[model samples]
Target: MKIDVEHVTKIYKDTKALDDVSFTLSEPKIYGLLGRNGAGKTTFMEILSGHILASDGEVLIDGENPFDNQRLTESICLIKEGDNFKKDLKIKNVLRIYAYFYPTWDQELADELIREYNLNPNAKVKALSKGMASALGIIVGLASKAPITIFDEPYIGLDAAARKTFYDILLEEYQAEQRTIIFSTHLIDEVSLMFEEVLILQDGKLVMQQQADALRDNAYAVSGATKDVETFIEDKEVIQSKQLAGMMTAYVYGNMEQAKSAGLTAEGIPIQELMIYLTENKGA
Candidate 1:
């Protein structure tokens, strides 16, 4: 399935959540949707799932608009941190209700996830801790097997071990299903490897979208003597710079070898650092 956002914009009273954002996903791949607080990441996903109408422009799934269309809406599953389940309902009942809603829901997968997450079917939703609630969302998202499965910061309150478990399960599920997966999270460095393509939004706009490896290759970090670093980045575009006691590290966007040739040590910048540099003050 393909998703195309053409001149998409979302406004809420005095604020514009999305400012004519535009992009396209031409194939089924893992996409990392990234942005800072109130940067329109959630709003963008809402538009894709047809949960809310865009203020202007359109979002198309395979050449057709998804607004109020049950066929397309059902095919896209958007899971978030706080999935509103009936507080008094037991875990089993919750899964049963979800099974009825999603045509492609897998009973076996649901059962497996319950055991994997160590969730009791008899326990009411209100009794579970925050992490357990996140686990339930993960189960529904993976077991639904929708063509476009979206996870928006779905692991809140999850410990490191539990978060790692979720990531492993997600990769395994995607491998077996071969569906379009959209994962939005602030933990970029840990989950960056999970993405084939990365889309970054800043201040309600699509700033950058590129293949993960290709994007990394286009940026580098230079460090050494302050004078040497400054000389190395004299003509290049410096995304970010920090100085302390005559030592400087400047994250620059350009050829990696160019900095190395100028007698400065070059290191690979992680996705999180790249994001910070790109959206620090004056955004990319």
Candidate 2:
């Protein structure tokens, strides 16, 4: 599903959650929507999923507005961190409710996930553990088969092994049938490789949006003598830099080959480090 977010903004009382952010996701690829707390990641996801209306601007999925549009909404599925299903309902009943809502729901996949997660369908949502609850949410998201699937920190209490399982299953599902997956998670190192593109929001504004491979292939940390490093990066797009004693280390978003040829020790910057450098309060 193609998404066009044009100057989208959301205000809550006195605070602006999203500030005229605009971007276009025009392919069926897994995108990593990242930011620290209060960066408007959840707000953007809510608007995209049709749960809420934007205060200004619009969120378009395949050229159609998402808010209050049942046809558009049925094609989108968003699974948040917690409190997804009703506490009084059993797992099976919850699945039934979701099946009714989603025309493309796959019961077989849901049943398989229930067995894999070792979840008893008869158990009520109130009785399940935190990890179990997260697993149920994951099952619903994967089985919904929506063209657009958004996961906002979907693994809250799952262990490392369980989270790994979810990642593996998600990739397998994506490979079998390509779909647009917007994954918002703090576990950057764990899933950064899965992201084709990355969007970063900071302080209610869109700060960065770039291809994952481009960031990995182009962003570099070059360190050497202060004067030499400074001269080398004088014309480069420096994301961040540090100078200590007679040595300097500069994180740049250009030309790894050029840095290497300049005799500076160049290493690729990890996505997590890049995001931190880009979104951190520079004045602080």
Per-residue lDDT for 1-284 in model 1, tens only?
A: 99999999999999999999999999989999998988899999999998999999999999988889999988998988795588999999999988988899999989998999999999999999999999999999999899999999998888999999989988998888789999999999889999999998988998889899887887888999999898888898878888999999998878899888888889888888788777766635
Provide the TM-score for each candidate, comma-separated. Answer: 0.93, 0.98
> What would the per-residue lDDT of candidate 2 be over residues 94-212, giving only the tens digit for each residue?
99999999998999999999999999999999999999999999999999999999999999999999999999999999999999999999999999999999999998899899999
- RMSD over all Cα atoms, model 2: 1.1
**Model 2: lDDT to the true structure:** 0.94
Best candidate, TM-score: 2
Instruction: Give the poorly placed runs of model 2, Cα more than 4 Å off.
Output: none
Tell me the lDDT of candidate 1.
Answer: 0.90
Identify the leading candidate in terms of lDDT. 2
